[model samples]
Target: MPQVQRVPMRAVKNVVLIAHDSRKQDLLDWVKYNRPVLREHRLFATGTTGALVQAQTDLPVTRFKSGPLGGDQQVGAKIAEGELDVLVFFWDPLEPQPHDPDVKALLRIAVLYNIPTACNRATADFLVASSLFHGEYERIVEDHAAKRQAWLAGQGRR
Candidate 1:
């Protein structure tokens, strides 16, 4: 079995917020309502969403490129590098996105890394309200490199 690794998270988290065009207002409302709790953490978002968030909520957000322009990949990269702690993405399930693959990949990475992810308002609220969200926490994830090495070695024997 591949070994697992524990990544320690600080009390103040690095949170990334994302929303589809149709869901932007919903996300904004949630952010506005939770501004007090959210202000305690570092914020990040994709282009237009970030701008809107900053304007509406008066919160500072590190902006990446727009989703279709590769912002989802940028956020995924940060997750892989252990830079992002939480993900609050309000995606439109009924609407197909131009960058659907990127969105799927981002969600996959978040699950693989075992980070806290919230896909809607209710879940987002619960995530912030959880005791774990306010304190130091340790995330356990599979050691990917070790698993890859084992698979590679087995392939060579075939």
Candidate 2:
């Protein structure tokens, strides 16, 4: 059986926001509409989007490098480190990104770590409106370290 833990998700979540060049306006507009909810949480974002969001919304956002320049990896590192609770990424599906592999890695890490992610405004809305949004919820996280230890033991390679 896989080990599991019931962690408390605070009423104020740690959220990362990112958007492609084409969807920056869309994300900004959505952020404006959801300011009340957003203000309650810790926010982070990539370079241009972060600056734009902070400028328009007046919400303090921790800024990272631009996505093409390593912002996606930065966010993925946060997820891997268990620092971010949710990811609200407004990626442009029609446009191919220069850092496409990085984008895929970010999404993959989010899922692997069981982080709540919103790829669109609709999903973001539902996420914020859900009963669990402001309350504690249980999520399953794989105990990879332990699993690796067990595998090493079984292989007699400890």
Candidate 3:
């Protein structure tokens, strides 16, 4: 039932980047301004967004396929598997997305996993400014042994 593995000092913070056509610029601006903070983490982005980020910022980016081509789900899978640390998805509210299901799934999974997520410029700013960005993160793994020992002791004669 536990979500993430309590990794207190990690070398890389797996961050996923996504942006609708209209919001691509927003993503770029944020990355441009916060490249220092972002550079310390490993970045993953979808298609053109990745190319753009790489071209504009100093951050290293691992690019997945385009969102419409399943990249969104790829990132979501990472979140579900606890491989992702944060998700900064700049979505265009006014325009309709072709990959609606993928977008919905990504949002749903992020919420389900209790991962830090930002859907717009303002939220992204807040997320980037959080002390957690520079501070250590504690990964909480399932304490299986502790639970089992406690159970055994509870049922013992002593």
What local lDDT does model 1 show for residue 44?
A: 99
Q: For model 1, how does the per-residue alpha-carbon lDDT over 1-158 read when each residue is reduced to its tens digit?
A: 66999999999999999999999999999999999999999999999999999999999999999999999999999999999999999999999999999999999999999999999999999999999999999999999888888888989942
For lDDT, the strongest prediction is: 1
**TM-score per candidate:** 0.96, 0.91, 0.80
Query: How well is each residue in 1-158 modelled by candidate 3, as lDDT tens digits?
Result: 52234645354678889999898998898899888888888899999999999988756789999999989998988877778888999998788888897899989988766778899988988987877766667745555556677778989923
RMSD (Å) per prediction? 1.3, 1.7, 5.8
Worst 10 residues of 3 by lDDT: 2-11
In Å, residue 3's CA in model 2 sits off its true spot by 2.0
Model 1 residue 26 CA deviation in Å: 0.6
Reference-based lDDT, residue 122, model 2: 99
Best by TM-score: 1
Q: Choose 2 or 3, whichever is better by lDDT.
A: 2
- The residue pairs that clash in candidate 1, if any, are none
Clashes of 1: 0
Model 2: how far residue 4 lies from native, Å = 2.5
lDDT of each: 0.96, 0.91, 0.83
Error of 2 at 39 (Å): 0.7
Between prediction 1 and prediction 3, which has the larger TM-score? 1
Cα lDDT for residue 48, model 1?
A: 91
